[model samples]
Target: MRFLPRIVTFFLLLPSYAWTQTMHNKRYNVLLICVDDLMPELGCYGNSIVKSPYIDSLAARSAVFTKHYVTVPTCGASRYSLLRSTLPRTKAALGNEAAKILSDPETAIGNEPETFIEQYRRNGYHTVGIGKISHSPDGYRYPYAGPKSDQRELPRSWDEVSFNPGKWGHGWNAFFAYADGESRITMQGEVPPYEAADVPDEGYPDGLTAALAVDKLKMLARQEKPFFMGVGFFKPHLPFNAPQQYWDLYDAGHLPLTAVPNIPANINLASLHNSAEFNQYRLGEESAALDQPLSDGYARKLIHGYYACISYVDAQVGKVLQALEETGLADRTVVVLWSDHGWHLGDYRVWGKHTLFDRALRSVLMIKTPAMSRCKVVNRITSTIDIGPTLLELCDLPPLSQADGRSLIPLLNDVQDKAWADVAYSYYNHGISMVTPQFRLTRYFRKEQPVIELYDHATDPLETRNIAERSPDIIRQLTPLWERGNTGVYAK
Candidate 1:
């Protein structure tokens, strides 16, 4: 009788043991690097002025997404969408949604409410979030009552670092401090001295976050556990503060200027939300010289500053990558570097990203996988939503019901049997922009009125000429496509 029981137990345990072994072999690690307020202006993206060697190198090793667009333009809204893999209706709605989730967890939005980090945790992968992974820190806290509403309700997935406390706009060499309620004049290109204990760009919140990530990589290597690490960098967004060396690299005399003409008189200012606020900041620049023709020289200087911040962020990325390589995690790790949304350096007569312009909506996305060859650039149109499903596929995890993204695995594997097209959508305030491989169509909606703008991206990459009136049929063809909601895998 004892021998019979042992035989039965051995037979039963075989399947479970085989399953465990399969799961272990299929597990893959993920490293998600997110930058704040960055646009697709890196050297890999063909910008000559910005010096982002780390990102450039990463680009060489990954699939460079040339037409990746975010669902929103602002930081909080855009990051929320990327985290959730869903687009917000408008800027105000997005902000309010974030506020509600942070204020009262029970009332958070989204029907399918699970974060990718949580999913990775469910699959036995260790997860860590550093820096600005969540829109605001408070969002991570519980609701004081029942089950928490935010996707982070799954607590086991993340381990966050302490918030680095510091002055808001200290690092950048900009002339004005948007810090206080009232703007004040500050010296431009002035690099303040710092103590050895003082934080460097990498040592600050972003740098500390990256350092913690590197440590986690090391720990994971020892344990042989697959990890999903999210390292968020907060720079090049506002204050534009970088080390003195970075600021010195850009000569204001040769900076490139913005080239947006005056807003047409026929357009209503009310159509664009928060136009007055944008103009207020521009007027505050106190540059009598900018009143004349916009010059690329001045624009190049701002570009240089933006690039310095990017390079600063890139160095942190290199740290994480180095740790991955040293830990022998590089071969199995799937690295994805992305920005929340594009930044506007005086494009469309706007200094920031609150509008539905390409400069404001586009982002840089690079993905490196063990399955793909190096230096491959995919010029297809994709969205932030695709990130969720793609990571899930990479980890061999089952797709979540709430995820509205599609897996880019087929695209990554270079499977010619599959056919894909470039199609991305972006929204800000009340405006929505649909980007095809060759065309960008924007529809600005109001309470009772709507305006449409179309640009042939192949010819008018800058979006200077609006051909909406000239191409009515094309507008008609694309409007219906925009109307279809949740067209991704989750919808099916």
Candidate 2:
């Protein structure tokens, strides 16, 4: 009788063992779309004013993370955490040049991988990078060299780093390019803050990028090996230039301005900064100030520019996603849309990122796996550090040993997974912030008064005021959580 039971168990395990082998061998493609300076103010996110139809369509069939945050508010540092799946441990790890280690000739790619893309490359996947995958547009260090320079930002990660500059001479020029074939750099601070060029989509670099991605999808579809394609869109970031048609989609006068325009009360000036990044446009009609808010007219106009750029990007994104479907790769591909970090669109009297506030740290995160049948809202707090492991798991690739983030497969399976932790950590402006459902606690490293701050999301979701002084008991409860995040910021 015992032998008969053992034989039955062996027969039952055969099907499951074959299924496991198939899962490991399955070739699932990845389409990673990285947008710069995009906030969660999309139509899908319940924003009434924005017109993001293409992204909203993707969100309809995807897992939209409502509380997705980045490890840093800046571009490169946040992307560093996403690519490495590791938290920032040193001051250099928190800077924009953090990923330069992957491209620097002196640095060696040893036994460990520097990025998830590299890991994917190792496991028989063809990786292609387009547009601004790294801090440098076109994945090259063109800012310090000529257009024809050969310097690379992520040299070994991608099989190829390519882009189309359109009318602009090079990638960097295309990034800051205007319709007149001149860029912000070439114009030397003489250009205005925004433009509604009367030209086709090809007039902007992102348009060219979308076209290139579409063409690449056709090529990748014919290849045997699975591929990982990263399409980084650079728009709605600075100079907010888009086609006039997109700008016409909104009435600037009726569009809503930011809530809580001034810096939050009870916070020191050291915790905030003057709008230096926004003021870089010397010819802009109005300069942003910390002491006062921008004029209503200017603020509305700027918001209009931002919205127009978003619509423009939305159309470009539609073209790429459509190409995926046309190529017949949509069924087997895992598509992910994420932003490097959120931008301060006149929120907190600041016009850019680099703050630990919610607006600056939170951005768009949408994932559409082939197995998911309908849209699901993931309400738990997730971080950029979790993206790499999630992608690897979705693709059934071996996990990277050095990643600090946990796979979000459980949340993806069950949107309201009770076993999941609901906290996300962010670092910026010499501060480490812990984000939960009801509160945000921050501890600053600088020698300023009121170095610790807390915001109650239930009453003041906009973070209009700091209640750390009045809520002593809450601070005591959140301090341990804040310290737990602090440990990740510093290496032992």
Candidate 3:
């Protein structure tokens, strides 16, 4: 047998995905920042243009997962899989309403504490969730344009779950709110796709969420219990709106456009869309379609709005990080910054996240622990489901049985870990896509011409073409590994 050299590792490994290392006797707290519809477009992710200074600074000291993929691409389903430490098994589980099951009367019975937050809360951690941590902006069950309900999205997860709707009157309204407190849901096709308001950061709901997070940190800092805090910021999602100052940070005329703005080769149109979600903004400059690309001017303008939203949210994150330092809780807390999923800035002529392509499935993830070695990029593939277990291990809490997620604590010890299984799974558009370091194989459960699509990342990093038709041997070898991800949840 081949031999390898001895190596050092974290001393507190125990059980499956459990770690007990600690900083003195103090309990470790967590501050989770959930950013909506964000890709790895930050400065640290090698996007030379998108202004994400705060997140970049955090990435400088954190274990950044460059290949982190979401179980689902949409905001709600992705977050549902994230909080539950599971993958999508049902069609509903792949939708925005997936979190409502946590409070379901009949089905939620016999659950293992509903969500990871509930797991923490049950174990004496003071769990606080604000903004859109689990689907709903305010953690409540309500229609997009209906009256607010007392029902909680994850009924037993957090000790306190909340969000301020500001002038929007309700959480759903705030989610789609404009600068004038009107939402696209209520106004119905009247709003544009983007906005740049000449107002302060507080003019946006995300700004208010940040201020609330800062306040909560200040309050939680004075407490004695170990805390689990989720701070969600809604920006760079839709109807991209931010303060004028953040908007001024970019020049639309000089913004970069998607290199491959047209559709990919040989994939079915069923795998793509006519940008129906982006079309909801009826007053936008131009509509995005699979046939042709958006005008260069309009595309640049949309990119400008997205970049501004990112910078605006980045400022809010900076505020919360500063609050942690000011409250003297920075040394005892683990900060995990993640985006629910990625977005298409006209990538492959798509403007949304409902597809199962790499552009939609891959997102940004960074975990910053007090004892972690200075900023390192873990090139290993990781899944969103792994986050919950990683948080448990990082905070020295007991491990829970997850659907497929494993502990990432070991990766912190060695970024180039050969023992790591470099594969991540995602489900959406009635399909399952698996991403490895060298390949991406997608199997769609539909009657499309090309049910199997494969992209070799080693040579085609841009995923320009599908080579599955020609690479029979590679596909045959990879199929069994990809099949492991099905797990009966995506069964018909």
TM-scores of the models, in the order given: 0.77, 0.93, 0.95
Q: Judged by TM-score relative to the true structure, which candidate is superior, 1 or 3?
A: 3
Better of 2 and 3 by lDDT: 3
Cα lDDT listed for each candidate:
0.60, 0.83, 0.84
Residues 1-492, candidate 2, lDDT per residue (tens digit)?
Answer: 000000011111111111112234567899999998998878878776789999988887777888899999988888888998988877777888878766665764467777999889999999999998778778887552345578777766899888998778888777777899998878876888899999989988999999999999999999889999999999888889999999999999888878667789999988787878778788899888888899989988899999999999999999999999999998888899999988788888888888998888988998887765456777789999999998898778888898889888788766567888889988878888999999999888777889888999888878889998899999998887777777455433
lDDT of 2 at 4: 7
For candidate 2, give the lDDT of residue 208. 93
Q: Give one digit per residue, the lDDT tens place, for model 1 in 240-322.
A: 54555555555656544554534422344443333332343343332212234235554454455665667667777888888
| TM-score of candidate 3 versus the correct structure, residues matched by position | 0.95
Candidate 3 Cα errors over 4 Å, as ranges: 1-21
Better candidate by lDDT, 1 or 2? 2
TM for candidate 1 is 0.77
User: Whole-model lDDT for model 3 versus the true structure?
Assistant: 0.84
Backbone collision count in every prediction?
17, 0, 1
